[model samples]
Target: MAILIPFGLKMQAQNNTSGNKILVVYFSHTKNTKEIATQIQQLTGADLFELVPSRDYTTDYQALIEQAKKEINADYKPPLKNNLQGIDQYDVIFVGSPNWWNTFAPPVATFLTSHDFSGKTIVPFITHEGSRMGRSEADMKKLCPKATFLKGLPIRGSSVKEAKPLVERWLREIGVMK
Candidate 1:
């Protein structure tokens, strides 16, 4: 179930004719992160890009958690199967990731580091079990030092399917939506 997204949300697409290009880049192992990414793409009329690591991750939840922890602890950046180019054209970049060990996943780190966001505005959106953003935002700031960051939106992983209203409210509060 990708998106049985609320009807109101479908009606909320801004189509962003303000002449600023936007992009939504995300990595989702459970599809929870992708759910929110899709909503933001629909609402903001942004380009959508998925970060697929070179190798598929383990399906075992316990193993996945252990692997993610090790990667995070080691500050390892996994190679992605796909990379986005022409990044300079976008003024706002929405970075979506599932929080791993209190931070964004390693693939997301690779994506951020691979681009030059010196003048771009980075908007982070995370799906977490309970940590809620955790150190994700601060970590992103360190990785993309020249980029301006908006207050991040954190939705519980289990609640992503029902996150429409919260997503809308945050977009409006951030002046991305009217």
Candidate 2:
């Protein structure tokens, strides 16, 4: 005999919670940052949005870094694929990205600059090889001047799955979960 469960209920059971309205926006180059975002979504039940670059970066790591440096140096704001509607509906905005050249990824910069996050609780999470949050925390402060910036979680890209404890701690810090 086979037992069947409602698909919707199964999905709902896998999510963290629906009590809190949260949004998770992230920029991932080689899927490192995306892994972190997925974990946060699991822990917070936040709606997820990918912060994609209008132009894909070069495949060569060093070339990509150099190109990213140029964009950051120029303070460029590349266009995003989609914009979050009803952003004000979310009580918390969890932004994620891979640290590039000691700062948040350029596409994430574009997303933050383009949106008005005033009065929102802005939480940042970053994955990096070694820099660890670097200048991202301060940079987010400047970008979302009107939003409440919470202390963020920084995890090594290679250790993303192992960061569940830290992510839960951060969620608790923000009062998202017990």
Candidate 3:
């Protein structure tokens, strides 16, 4: 079962072997992305923060797609309902988002741009139908030029509920778990 860890809550991880403070920030329109975020926390003991827009996106799939497409075409970054503080304290950030319009959701753009990730590391995790990472990784690099990125994880949205093992393996492969 996916843990319903509240967004923005800081939970001390049990196995922070790297000794670097870590945070998981994500934008989940559906719960698929959130489920992956929860798994990352369970594996690495990272804190969780949800990215919420000041205005929620429409629930209708077609409407949301059109909305996302327009936002991406314009390179828009919507205002977030909440933003993290003391961002400089975290050494690594696991950024999660649904692959929307071939990119990370707009709120993710705001979150990445709003912080100074210079000298920091970003571990990207994306959920998608079939687009996979699409242009999201490329766009993320543009958003945070100074941040170092590990290889990203792209899970099929339908497979998320069965993904704990995959998630654990990914953490080990990335050297986040050793």
Cα-based lDDT for every prediction: 0.86, 0.79, 0.87
lDDT of 1 by residue, 68-165 (tens): 99999988999887767678878888999999999999999999889888989999999999999999999999999999999899999999989988
In model 2, pairs of residues that clash are: none
Greater TM-score among 1 and 3 belongs to: 3
lDDT of 3: 0.87
Q: What are the per-residue Cα lDDT tens digits for candidate 2 across 7-32?
A: 32334334545354677888888888
Residue-level lDDT of model 3, residues 59-151, one tens digit each, is 998999999999988989999878688888889999999999788999999998899999999999999999999988888898899999999
Which prediction has the highest TM-score against the true structure? 3
Counted clashes in each candidate structure: 0, 0, 0
Prediction RMSDs, each to the true structure: 4.3, 5.8, 3.2
Task: Tell me the TM-score of each prediction against the true structure.
Answer: 0.91, 0.87, 0.92
Model 2 CA deviation exceeding 4 Å by range: 1-19
Q: Scored by Cα lDDT, where does model 1 land? A: 0.86
Give the poorly placed runs of model 1, Cα more than 4 Å off.
1-14
Which pairs clash in model 1?
none
